[model samples]
Target: MKPINRRSNAPVFWGLFGAGGMLAALFGPVLVFITGIAVPLVLILPADAMSWPRMQAFAQHWAGKGLLFVVVALFMWHAMHRILHSLHDLGVHAGTALKFACYGLALLVTMTAAWILVAVGF
Candidate 1:
């Protein structure tokens, strides 16, 4: 039997999906609590926990920009990966085109987020 050709790029997308899933799991609940529960009730976190000026300051900070960029872009990657696979499962076998669309959209979002963050200026 000839040696199998096992090389593939699935690892790259899988890596992004894993990382994004982890980040989303870690932060998703906190965000929901803050925006969905705490903020609405104004009982746990302070009323101004996410007020405009405070959020503006946070977004303008370099560290905060980095965090936002990572979270947004990674989540986009995760979503795209999921969508691409789901399309395949649904009988859409457009291979290279599908991969390009999904990953390209993710790349576009990532670059846009980075540019906006940088432009916002601290």
Candidate 2:
């Protein structure tokens, strides 16, 4: 009989992790500093910059929906990857079950974000 071949899903998750890490490094802090803190305290960017109407309008756009979905999904996959690897150092010893749990949660969030984005309409 021919040898069996098994493919690992690690690369896909690693790719997502790298992309998300880059995104987070590049934009995450600025976003938090600007929206989470500045918008509330700085009195700089105009309070309405992140207002519901503006946000809703952005979400209603195709590009905005794509950005939102990619950001949410990639960040989630990135976080899950980190958590899975961290477990080893913490003595949790990542296993198949743990892998499933981590990746499964990422998949769930991705699906949910996609569903919501689609429902938001164009």
Candidate 3:
């Protein structure tokens, strides 16, 4: 049989998943420790570590915006890919429509994050 050739855009999603997983591995625990335990328990970081004004100021900074955007957007991409694959594994098999919905939601959230970050005023 002649090789049945198919082209897929999976690399893009896989790249996002890989990058996001790396980032999540690096930052997720730190975030949980800081926000979840440290801040709440007032153990290591100050309790106001995530206070509104301080967070607003951080969001207004260019570097902070970049970091926030990358974290939020990449995480969304990672989640969408995982959910899409899970649906496939479950035999949902909705094809392009499902792909559009998954990635579209991630894109929508990413854009919303960018807009909110910009609105925070640099």
Candidate 4:
């Protein structure tokens, strides 16, 4: 008897969520520290560590663009998945429409970020 390949795509979504959660946990605080404290307080980075021109250049760079894309996309997937699962955990009625809406919003944000980054020019 031939067995059917009935695997689901849940792993992919879970992987994205894991990556995003890790990134958010690791980088979120570091980013905030650098931008909010270090730059302003002259601790590690310079005052203009996040200046406009520098930020524009970062967005224009290939590595920066990819980093931005991955972070944004993963974060969207993580947030959407969390929300969907949390609703279920909280005993809320999570229907297909809710799934579509949450995932759809994540996709929308990711696409918008990508478009804006591309429009920012390379």
Query: Of the candidates numbered 3 and 4, which has the greater TM-score value?
Result: 3
Worst 10 residues of 1 by lDDT: 89-98
lDDT of each: 0.90, 0.90, 0.90, 0.88
For candidate 1, lDDT tens digit of each residue in 1-122? 97879897889989999898898899878878888999879977899988989888999988889899989999999999989988888999757888899999999999999999988889
Q: Report the CA-based lDDT of candidate 3 relative to the real structure.
A: 0.90
For model 3, where is the 10-residue window of minimal lDDT? 2-11
Candidate 1 local lDDT, residue 53: 94
lDDT string, candidate 4, 39-109, tens digits: 88999787788899999999999999998888888888999999999999999866879978988898899
1 against 4, candidate with superior TM-score: 1
RMSD of each predicted structure: 2.3, 3.3, 1.7, 3.7
What is the C-alpha lDDT profile of model 3 across 16-100, one tens digit per residue? Answer: 9999888988988988898789988999788788899999988988999999999999989988888998988999985788989
Query: For candidate 2, what is the lDDT?
Result: 0.90
Q: Which scores higher on TM-score, 1 or 2? A: 2
Q: Estimate each model's TM-score.
A: 0.86, 0.88, 0.90, 0.83
**Candidate 4 displacement at residue 45 in angstroms:** 2.0
Clashing pairs in 4: none
**What lDDT score is found at residue 76 in candidate 2?**
91
User: Best TM-score goes to which candidate?
Assistant: 3
Q: Number of clashing pairs, model 4? A: 0
Mind giving the per-residue lDDT tens digits that candidate 2 earns over 95-114?
Answer: 88999999999999999999
